[model samples]
Target: MPAKTKTSFHKPATWSDVAPLLVDVAMGRQKADLVVRNGRWVNVHSGEIIPATDIAIAGGRFAYCGPDASHAIGEGTRVVDAAGRYLVPGLCDAHMHVESGMVTVTEFCRAVIPHGTTSMFIDPHEIANVLGLEGVRLMHDEATAQPVNVYVQMPSCVPSAPGLENAGAALGPKEVNEAMAWDNIIGLGEVMNFPGVAANDATMRGEIAATVAAGRTVGGHYASPDLGLPFHGYVAGGPEDDHEGTRAEDAIARVRQGMKAMLRLGSAWYDVASQVKAVTEQGLDPRNFILCTDDSHSGTLVKDGHMDRVVRHAIAQGLNPITAIQMATLNTAQHFRLERELGSIAPGRLADFLIVSDLAALTIDEVYGRGVRLARNGQLEIDIPAWSYPASARNTVKLGHRLAAKDFDIAAPKGTREARARVIGVIENQAPTRALEADLPVAKGIVGMDRRNDVCQIALVERHRGTGAVVNGFVSGFGYTQDCAMASTVAHDSHHMIVVGTNKQDMAAAANRLGQVGGGVIMFSKGKELALVEMPIAGLMSDERAEIVAEKAEKLTRAMRDMGCSLNNAYMQHSLLALVVIPELRISDVGIVDVTQFAKVDLFV
Candidate 1:
């Protein structure tokens, strides 16, 4: 009898093939493809640090890991001496947005590979909002082309919030079911509509049901602090894991409710330290908790690190080194139902691991993906090709006509000299905002920004439809002391045009500047452009190299700081001004959204 035909040489072998290969390699009947010699394995399954372990690889899978692989290694087999280093499993990002890095998928992989990130579960909802299902397919296809493992999560909410906001594109239950059949799509992306879930909205439930029916995990984003009936209802709606918790109790509650607790440490979000206490102080099961970076910008990925930085932060927050590594590795894999294929250095798993010189320092000397060295000494050793999207992704910033100062003017009430206005107060390093009220003097029949009180005007331009609609409101957290404006087309969920400035002239200039350059971020101060980061791809991400994007992002940050804006990671705060899905106050194309009420409210009372 002849053997069966296989799809690919590197594909996971059937039990019969893997079982035979294991026994043959152990008995020296078959030569191993590669052998990693003399290393201390950080065994996540048993929580033991086993020294003098050898890992043998064949067909891109681990065939044997024991005291020695000398018999398995023949003249044709390659050998890599670990030199008594720590063999840690390749890091995995459980939840992340590739667009937040402001680079293409290939560029993001290139940037994080050196940091020992071997697997990523990406939510391309940003692009989904821009180009609909076609955008998601583009991301999924590009993810498949990468050398490292990059899985896609079908976007659960394209517009994010129905009725409350309108995105460039919309997705529903049909799209969810269609995406589930794709080879690269592992599950559904973050279901951001907590209100709908709590109210048993049909659309939200339908999407969740489709994901569940497909036997895939449902990502969650319950941004509200009310972990009461609403949280319980969302959990019951079938979201398997959530990363929006910012408190210790939030982590404890999620784990208690049989949902995985994902603690994120992004470039701006400082959430891990507060939530990780559930395990360190409250004595919760660490197995139910995972570490992730929900959104990381190019500057952080280039200058700092990726999952390695998150693991180090977890360790510094009073977690044991092995435990922290497990949160970023095995814990994430288990939640995604990919434990057998990844997240550990055991037999029958993909041969992906990192060689670290110091466990305490986490200094990665080499990174391996599928038994191949991808990075060495903090730089990528492998060449990853760049990918390009269709022309539809470019020139996304459609302002209808060039914006002017008059478009931002807020007309005062007929005879009103003074008015109290609802202002969106940005909370530094968090997603939620405070609904603040401020008294302002009406001048020349127009309501103006109170610069003396650090108040600035915010406007949302409908860029997708070219409606030329500018919804005006006030925001009081950037602390800008100059007559400057910051404009971006990367507004969250909706991806509309957001302009914030003290003076309307600079606002117009900044808005028009992005319009002229296709789409990107621009900072204009005193009528002169201070910084511009061109994101021609969907007006959200740049197609340039990661390092180039990081340089431009650094300039944008410095320019914001130079103009007296002092909130930490103010760029993240700036981009999220139009995110109506989160809480308290936000601006949209329709009107100023009082998210606490989940309805549009008057800017002035």
Candidate 2:
């Protein structure tokens, strides 16, 4: 039997046809598809904030925006009185990862739309790492079905660092070529391995060549801050935009090299304030700057906001409100070659906008998407379905058997009372970690964690197969107290289980909890489970609704805070334990990576 038919919305042919419809709606002679009256239009195009404006939308596009609305009140038109709220263009996140939210695409959209985010440029590299080209296509198809604009970027770095990571799937030039032909694919995802680009690696060149040949954007991820010859070489490699800029100089260099500098402010990474200085202070062109949330978790989106939080942070950093809004809206849309359909409240653009009370505070009163009111008064009005991931995507945590306390014990060199060990230090609200060496005492020829030194044991349990190979090490900066343990299967690219705790038994219990539930994040304190988010799909996202995942994540974060961990958004730092790409230190299924040197290293000295 044939599959159920999908609903198709009408698309306007040109602006000429859209203008009279706008006039008819405003004059109240013809009914509008949806009308938002008495709003202060925060027009990003003209950089003006016009008060007492009315907006008319039809066919999922803006039909009119003006002061009068007497003619657009025909029968059967859905009318929403704005009550003098500011009508700003729908926000656009220039770069992000849906997997980082720990929820599926349907859920991620539900979490952010109420916060006024109507468009996103997502890179599904995490799923691609586990399921290859099929995974990327699945995400693309799902994103196209959404009412909001969810553009997919083809995964550019599957393994991320080839020869360094053994991912579930590998993508080459063939995959890139195929993805380029997809309808919703915006461009190539973040080219993470800048070293490979500079060294002229064949795989990197081949993927970039495919994307360039397709006339699409090549996203960049130059994590290194050094603005030298290698930086120049990376720019020459054809990435048109970069979002890893953490400093003012990094932003300046990217703009100078003709690339849009994306300033991100996610849960852990507070990069926007530091990098936006290039435009606000160094006289760099504002057009070359964009705003994004590179890696926001579900909790951050539900508790705080999405691009709204980033724009507020930029404003507090002394940037003009208009400029910040522009960075998050039009600038992002232009970068992805989607300026015509989105990023503004102009005619022919998607009817997506936020009704706000104040520009500085960004107090959103209502949000509209596809000519419909999806959210109002900080709550979602539309009901989104739970995304169904294939059964093969579940039970990814194949730890063979339950983990034991002995698996977490790191044995010291023979006949040594003490040893100098390499510990992974978690830097609060930052991506780069500090490589710290500590001298610790040994017990029964094994290294022990020093509670007084804020040191805790960290274990990477191989979950891809039933290989219960647990590699143990030490970590700092969590400030976890009361013999607690936290375990998650959302460990970076590989999505392995990373457990950190001061008590050995708790570490074992935490790992076992994830194993029992298939895969998810869990916190165990004093032998009692505190919180868990069941992300059974590929061990990264849940089949549950987005709100349910957000609520669970909130509980997990609050549990962390109650455990005496005060670092802002520490959960994000916890999930990056197995990233294996960020500098200084990271853990993978293979071993701990000294990312500064791009090589694996011994855990003890």
TM-scores of the candidates in the order shown? 0.97, 0.93
Question: In candidate 2, what are the lDDT values of residues 198-316, reduced to their tens digit?
Answer: 98999999999999999899999987867898899999998898988788988988998999999999988999888888888887879889999999888788889899999999999
lDDT of 1 at 13: 48
- Which stretches of model 1 miss by more than 4 angstroms? 1-23
On a 0 to 100 scale, what is the lDDT of residue 297 in model 2? 88
Expressed as tens digits, the lDDT of each residue in 458-488 for candidate 1 is 9998999888889999999999998899999
Task: Tell me model 2's lDDT, rounded to 2 decimals.
Answer: 0.84
> Model 2 off-target regions past 4 Å?
1-31, 67-73, 76-84
Candidate closest to the true structure, highest lDDT: 1
